[model samples]
Target chain A: MKYITHSLVILLSFLIWAGTAHAVEKTSGQSRLPVTESMVNQKFIFIGNLIKRSKTFKNIEAHGDEDVFEDIANVKALYKKAELSVQQGDYEVANNLLNEIVKLVTSITRKESKVTNDQTNSLRYYNERKATIIALMKTFDEITTNEQTANESLEPRRRMVDDFLNQAKSNITNGEVDGAIVNVDKAYDVAIRITIEVRDGITLIRELNFETAKDEYLYEIDRNDSHYFLLDITVKEKKPSAKMLLSIQKLREESDGMRADADNEAKSGNYEAATDILNKSTKNLIRAIRMGGNFIPG
Target chain B: MKSGYWLFILTICLSGSGIAASFAQEYDILHPPLGTEGIYDPENPGIEYLQQPSEALSLLPSSPTGNYVDWVKAMDDSLIEPRASIYGDQIMRAISMDVIMQQTGSMPYVRFPHYDHSLILSCTNCHTAIFLPKKDANPVNMYTILKGEFCGVCHGKVSFPLTDCFRCHSSVRDKRVLDE
Candidate 1:
């Protein structure tokens, strides 16, 4: 009974974690700024996430199309470029652009937030600030884009990777293995790493770091042809965190049905339905809680 | 020096956008730093990346021991990607929540989707502070009824009008229609 209970507990947690774990792990393409050549972690990875949902956060109050200015503007423009690339079958370009937006947004937010005055009227300049979130919402309304991808209450980095995975999977299905590999490779590197020491003699100190793996991979891509994805995948070598694997598995699970639905739905010109089915397949995944007393009022 | 560099980098990022959505909004206690125009100015108090010498230097993990620096660096290095060993409470909550989201197909909790980090405003945003930087810490309050706390704070507001009871309490037993 005890062992059965424990197994149930573990499975339940994995399902929960799995929903949040899947985000893009890798970034590819020989792309450039307005997007890249910027710091991802350095940007506001989570900035304006809530602001976008703010009722007061209007897309435009006065002089413009909300998304064409400041940081929010940059994110939208970048996301737009990425989407266009994907549409045009330029996965490499899409990869770089997306990476740029994620990094730039995250990096900029952290910097701005720390310096921001947490005032009673955080919406004082509700005009400008809110505009930022609203603009991104309009431009990149993708599944995990500004509006839909707001509740980061769960594990965010994991979701970041998961979003990437979904994007990559789309590329893979279209036989864009290079593009898919580029995307997954980024996710893999970003999500895994092995510690090493350099100086006299490079001693690979044992440590699997997500940032390291990402940096090392990014470093490689940055050095060589940014488009050439180093295809040396070994799940055993890096050993994805249970969290990541679960996310991937969940995405894979939902995708099977989603793929079929997406294909047929698109054939019918139901982009919204196609997207909804795909999103629904990946979203609302918390329902997999195998019925049992994983939750007993203690 | 380490925290200073981090702050410096952070300042540049925040000025470019908004702030405190993902990490380090603990300073919200000192509310209303300045008007948007003033802080956004190149020559303002917020402009200079205040170099408060962080005591975290000692916490920095040396060549290869176990300390705060190493932990953060490891995270920076993406070392913690695979370990998803959750606790009993986390598991229970996940199970309960997943069932709720699955059934509803659309809930405030699912709207946030975890990595939506910027949505968080306080430390108690998720766990009873269970999700801390350090793994082994005091057990976050679970059973105690928290009012206006993490999930409670926004559930009724921006996240997803949590007026619907069944949206969260999965095992509420009486599965009839909820009074909106």
Candidate 2:
């Protein structure tokens, strides 16, 4: 009887221990199964859709070169492997593969961004240089024609600038942006040099023909405004002496009065008188600017 | 006696298995055990664990105030390239016009260079919204600017601080008088 009791006690204890252990194991395994499976499925679908709809991916497809193409192909292959891993219930492997795909795509996008930015910069620089050269050419023509100073020496330089500009345009048509920029820069240099030489040359032969007094008045206004701007820049830069400052102040007051008189004349429809008064105002400003130790043409 | 012992053993075994199974079913991946819900899980993370601006902005050029990064310089230096549009491959067209604003006081006039702004922004960003295209339409004063109007909208908010005055008030005052 004692033996039977001992046997029954041992059997009961073993059954309890075994039952608990097996229940814990079964619960842990089953708990992870559904969640892992669903999560893997969702992530796979998400990444796949992301790749398909990504702007970077589309940009690469449209503009990617051979090396970029290879990188994108590798991304596709890794994505497929991640999909297979998800199907096989290997969530860990699938997650790692998906991460690799993301890294690869990120690197590709970064490279593409640089390429696009460089292209944009090149085109913008070319356009800016082109516009500057054209404006400089107009200034060169106006100064040469109005002053009639050293035309014999300037015409050749003018033709050279025109040739450079034409070359720049042709280079742009051929998709050589760097070449275009170089040509445009050369054209600008020549054109600006020609204008500066003519304006600075002491030949005071101003034969400007304006169709209307208002037109000449408008021109004088622009001239006065520019001189005023130059005077301001020079004073801040040069920091002239007190004596020079006093002289500048007196000149400035006179110029201001003249400017007011000119504006009144213009309002009263006496544009010719306004033009003369404005020109005098500009000459005073120029003298004051010179007192500040700066040399600018009036 | 043997039969009663067998019956007792059988009852204990059945009850022990039932209790163990029920306890196991109480916890799972979705329904975690009580008191363990707040614990960090490696498999699943919250949004707080993702990349934050504080960490990312450190990589860009640092500024004194307003914007943490010098965004315009960053773009110019090729440190960052932000897309101008989301729908297509659009680029910003830089306008190279300079507009001079006459000052009321003795301060130098403000020369607003459209090239700098238009290089990064679209015309619609400020036109018809913050400023009218027409001349003198927007009465931009320092008081209004300091109060977060006109240039202040971006200057003290995202671009740079307002304390740097010489940057905008660059054109000097012309102090010259004309001869009779």
Candidate 3:
């Protein structure tokens, strides 16, 4: 009993330490998306919580709907797969799988609204999954942004970027959102590689092209301001959570700052830098719209 | 017949209002056909049958369930069964059964016709999965059904709204009425 107690204390202490470390690192922003041991541990705890919540939802057991049962089984399998991926240190795959599980669980809950006797338990489960998905998305966003920044100084892998971008676009058109995301991630990875074999970098013609693209974005930002206002009104009317509203606000501010930076850089004849800033700003805006604009009707 | 004239008037009115009463009749491949009710609202007076009671059936004094029963009897079994399968298997074995719910006073008893559903869905769709094969095993209520737990799973999202009470609760307990 003494040995067991001691072991428990040690484990608890380690978890607390990890949590503290993760919080500190996040605030510090040492690396935009440093996938720490704590994040993986948190995921494991969430998975455990989900299992407990599923048990509380006795409908899955009491009811005999094959589709419902199949869905539950699929979620469980996904959770296991995510855990395995985490163990193998494949954080991206793990996170993607976790995202899938989150989407599936949330969608199921949405379809079968208030069916569970324990509404509180079901809600908690849904909220926890949503929170985890947000964390994963944030981490990926930061990683992509930071890595893209680093890759800017390298020789432009234009061909690779074009190919990946095309593939991503096609995937999106085909309604393969996950597949599109994966392709975009790959494109970013390829585009950012600072190769040792440096040829002539930042030609004048390329600079002119980037400047043109930057100007187009500036026009877009101005045009989209009206859309943003419309979205804000709609979102407010819908009475979204304070947290969602806050996220939208933060993204808008970030986009504004990036736009300003891009404008200044372009004026100073550093088109490449300006373009990069503009690109980041555009991405931030897109992410903002995607997250909050789900309520907006077509 | 007067019914034929009413049908023509209804068609003209619906077309004039620019509501696709015919277009919506096209069975959604995404959500399987469960049946619909022709809602009569004085505020919006128009023939409102989205996917149930058949496009052929007109809005008459008869209950939507009665219309559904008549439609099911006349409908080709192969048309609704062969193409659509929301739960995997396309070849669904039809089972005919009725769940007679005991309701008091003006509240009509629920006559759950498995025959109509089985035309599109298999026995495994609800049996032992959503509902047990035994009678009165599942404690079903309007509140729970509205929450998409039991019948509401298919009804509101794909089929039709539960606002039309007579659609499902069309069973008459009176011996003479039931015999007719």
Candidate 4:
């Protein structure tokens, strides 16, 4: 009876060991399949969605091009093959087939020429450019009006933009889309230049009058935040030497300490003292930004 | 004693079968192992030869990070000619102007350069969409920029990242030094 019991234990142990190892192998294999299968599935869905939404595809369908239709049919058939390969655990073949489908779809949808062989596509492109130019002109008008200043210097450039826009409109009326696109581009360039000029002339002016010490302190806080932000950007851009970096770090630490002190003062209702400390902190940060290679006035 | 002998025989047979099964699982050429595909062989010269970014962008100017190339410099140097427009005939007229933002206290004012931007991009790319074409209209600050607003849209994304601060804050405050 002892011998039988010992033999039974040994047999049971072997069976359990084999079962665990097989389970582990099966699990690992299953984990790998989902990742590849999902990725291929996503690509398949994306292409299908793109085809459904594409204006180019709609145009092709309207034209009743048998060759293009046949090509699309082939893509569908290949997709099925890819799906079958995935099910059969042949991921490499499936990936290759998907890549081929992407290439075919791209080729099928691509415009034959830059101007586009389709009249509707060209008209759409022209209309988009015209709308953009009109919006830009409106923006320029609004900026000049807000400034309440006559931009005598920019008058010529503004005229140039208007002239180009008019020329583009005439070209479109004459059914010359290619020429219209060029004129519209020229108009866009001038309009942008005028907008930049008008914007650059205007400066942000803040009223320094404060109703209370707390209001002054709040203003100081915003100033400190701006300097801190500038310092961070300067440090990133400059790629300062190690020695310069150390100096900047020291200044930053000093500023941070001062800022904490100011916060404490503000909590105790010493707004005047808190503002002074915050001003010192902001100056320290300015020094750090200068050291980082931006010579901002402190 | 007879039962013990039979159990020993069965265990040996099972162990032998497991070993055979593991050997059978070993991959052959037909079902080769999956890994980092596309190993380059000089003689075979397959379609998918792997090339490092460093090797590809070796001719371009280096950035602060050794791995990245300064793409703007590469474009300026005419080492790469990217199309300005999708249409074949659209001309890119680059404007050279600097807009200085002097509202910053204690920090150097921010100076925006149009020359670099206009070289490749159309004015429409930024105007009215990313930025309103008026000063003070867009409340631009460090906090807003870091959060990916205003200049944050391209500065930290497609263009050079915002970490290079002095690039924009190039203007110095005009302080007259008194004769000591």
Candidate 5:
């Protein structure tokens, strides 16, 4: 009878242990199922939508208006990595990557705030300076009747200066002080250079016309024409002196050489170089006119 | 409400002209055509550029000589009385209070005043939508502001921009408070 009691007691203890173990196992299994389902269903769907949004953003990035955003490559990489991470069940890492992408997108698309009272002042200053430069160019235009010389010589540089000034003003308004300063400096440098060149060209042309009687001779040199024609009607009665003719011939030779070089540069799509050469050519012709000293035949 | 009405008009004009509202809204602090005359003379030291079409000619110089706070106070004193008739009972507050911000170590303490804004805006415009009612709850930073969060929502869009540090960080004291 005692042996029977010991066996029953051992069986009861075994049953209790097995029941408790089964209960604990069921509890853990049930908890795990919900977590897995939640993660797979909710997070995966959410991540899927995020991925779609990112894909559209990527397409826009590929064909966007400008290459303003530098970190587009990094964003693409992060997006692909985020997808992989989500697939690998690393939601934490995927979430972080998504957040990073969001921040980057915001920064790229966002219009930066305008800051600094000085920006307004600087823009005004640049505009005022630009106006002055333009006025100077106009003055040069008025002094030089040669439209080609006046326009070709300084217009491109003037445009560049204007563009730089406008860009600087924009940078200032956008609070990019360093960029603004650089642009402003460039604008100032270009303006100063152009101003000097324009002034010199105008002065030389004026002096040449006053001394050479070139304008009074009714001489208009066509750039395309091989020959330089000086209408002899004005000096028909008074033939040019031998010394003046020799000076004119030498000046004509120098001018022709420059014109040839300028044509070559222009053919090579170096208009700026051509402009420079023509500017020199124009100045040389003016100088020749000055050297001739109003020669007329008696 | 008057500012809002003006903003609406501006928005309509901009939309009609096919110009971006943001582009129209963001104007230079010192507008050109600086002189009283039609000429855009930037060198003019007169207060012509400072005059808003809505306000009478200000006695203050274009570039005021006093401290920012004093200048602002003087502007308030001069204009507030005349504006009272126009505002009638619409003015939100009679006195000004400053919300001293010193949390961030990188910035000078910002003394945000209620005087200028309260005249135009009500409490509900910012209290719950942008900022918490309680003090020390909002963590204002340059990055977030640049992102158009917190003060940026109104500032960069409608109000005075966040570019001028002295505009907000006007306190004379140099107390630094570390972020918790």
Candidate 6:
């Protein structure tokens, strides 16, 4: 018991030291991107060492020489290390933790690619993965966040995003994003933390949607050479974002109207009028399709 | 002489315009059949070009006109460069441009408006053709036409002399056509 207590103190001290060092590095901006691959390599070793420690510790349990109290202290230390690296923008380290975290939660989530059910450690692994993903999200957030100020046209939508973000702010204060996404490794509906100001002389709306691969929305924004800016984001599962469905629905209505007009023209024997209407309606209907999705898929 | 020149000019220009319209219909190529013109607007009425010379102009019963018709309209497929669909080659063989002035150059004008460049794209603007935005459906490939053969019909014959090769090959080579 005495040996266990001493080992716990040592483990706690090491974790506190690692976290403090990471915190100091962040405020100084020394550890942000353009982050060297070597720096990632350094942390890889640390994570590997942690995994080895866990495996060895598991083995020692067979001999009854292993101390749960000391080992738990070590795990706490590892979590603290990951938290600090994540705060300092060292995501490789944080990601390494999530890899271990998945292992920690594997027994609960073994059968599914995604876990809809919440278990005890499942909650813990979810938070860790969420942190890693949030780190990835930060770079994208910076890209689309401030695009609004340049666009004066989308003032209404921008205001809505702002209001929702504020509500999210209070949630973040109360641990809303972190609490919900705790341990399951899915994209958390965290407070929309990224913020941007909309300025004048720009007229466009851009939303950062990493929901699927084929969505070249951000690439399109980058390609648009002049006179346009991005709109703020409002991420959610059911928002039917991208306004794709809405545009297709509108196009279908217009094409149907045009077809009716064409039928009327044909019935009246206005060949020229019918031809023009049919041609235009067909072109619009073709555009309503996605990359092999409709007739095709949704 | 000046009065005579004016009379000749008047005859040629008016006849050219009329013939351009009739010829377009006679061939029955791509444009709507003859006289199917839309109502002309009196105020700011657009030019009503038939897109080609009327066949009536070239059928004047004179030797030059007759020869012009023969060369521009009646080309022997054998004489045409093997599979050479050049506008100049087609026009030249079709109308026997050899009998006109009889001077053929390396490059001959087959059709008035070449479809190769945008500045000369009025023909294909609406008329569908190969590599579209092409005006004439049967485009004489510029290379064959310019080779003093096929489409060099009326263009190289009575129209613009083919010896003036600088019109098409002007930007291509350093040496301009050294001949008059």
RMSD vs true structure, all candidates? 30.6, 24.1, 37.4, 17.7, 35.0, 39.9
Model 4, B1-180: lDDT tens digits are 789778876876776576554444433222222232244443332222333333346557767532356777888889888787687566676666555666555556677777778778776667656765444566666667777888888877877776665666676655231111
Top candidate, metric TM-score: 4
Model 5: DockQ against the native? Answer: 0.01
Tens digits of per-residue lDDT, candidate 3, B80-158, equal 2244456753344344445566521224667777657866663335644466443335656554565577887887566
* Model 6 residue A172 distance off true place after TM-score fit, in angstroms: 2.4
Q: State the TM-score, rounded to 2 decimals, of chain A in model 3.
A: 0.27
Assess candidate 4 and give its TM-score to the true structure: 0.51
Q: List the candidates ranked by TM-score, beginning with the highest.
A: 4, 2, 3, 5, 1, 6
Across A207-283, the per-residue lDDT of candidate 3 in tens digits comes to 11224755554544443443454345446544567898798779889888987887788788776687667667756
Per-residue CA lDDT of model 1 for A1-298, tens digit only, reads 9798567556645544443332111113123423322232222232234234433223321222333247667766776666566667665566667668667755555444433343322323222222332232222233233325434442354455556566666874675545655565444332221100001111111121325433333222221211111111122323556775565456446645665676587677665566556554433222221111011121
Total clashes in model 3, counting residue pairs 3 or more apart in sequence or in different chains: 5
Off by over 4 Å in 2: A1-47, A55-73, A83-96, A99-125, A136-161, A173-178, A185-298, B1-167, B170-180
Task: Please list the residue runs of candidate 6 whose C-alpha ends up more than 4 Å from where it truly belongs after superposition.
Answer: A1-152, A178-298, B1-180
What interface RMSD does every candidate have?
Answer: 29.7, 23.5, 35.2, 15.1, 36.8, 39.3
- Candidate 2 clashing pairs? A251-B176, A251-B177, A252-B176, A252-B177, A253-B177, A254-B178, A255-B177, A255-B178
Give the per-residue lDDT of model 5 (tens digit) for A159-269: 887798789878868877668767866775565565445443221100112234332221222311212222121123235678876776687688889888877876786
Candidate 6 achieves a global lDDT of 0.38
The candidate scoring highest on DockQ is: 4
Q: Write the per-residue lDDT of candidate 2 for residues A34-54, one digit (tens) a residue.
A: 335666777788778778887
List per-model TM-scores for chain B: 0.20, 0.58, 0.52, 0.63, 0.52, 0.20
**Model 1 chain A lowest lDDT segment of ten:** A193-202
Compute the lDDT of residue A157 as modeled in candidate 2: 95
lDDT of each: 0.36, 0.70, 0.53, 0.70, 0.52, 0.38
lDDT of 3: 0.53
Instruction: Give lDDT tens digits, candidate 4, residues A1-298.
Output: 9899778768767765775586466334422233366666666676656556667666655663577788778878887887788779787788788789888877776633233556676676667666667776777777567766546788788888889989999998898887888898788777766766665433333213578999889868878886788787788777899999999999999999999999999999999999999999988887888788876566
Could you give the interface RMSD of candidate 6 in angstroms?
39.3
Q: Who is ahead in lDDT, 1 or 5? A: 5
DockQ, in order, for the candidates? 0.03, 0.04, 0.01, 0.10, 0.01, 0.00
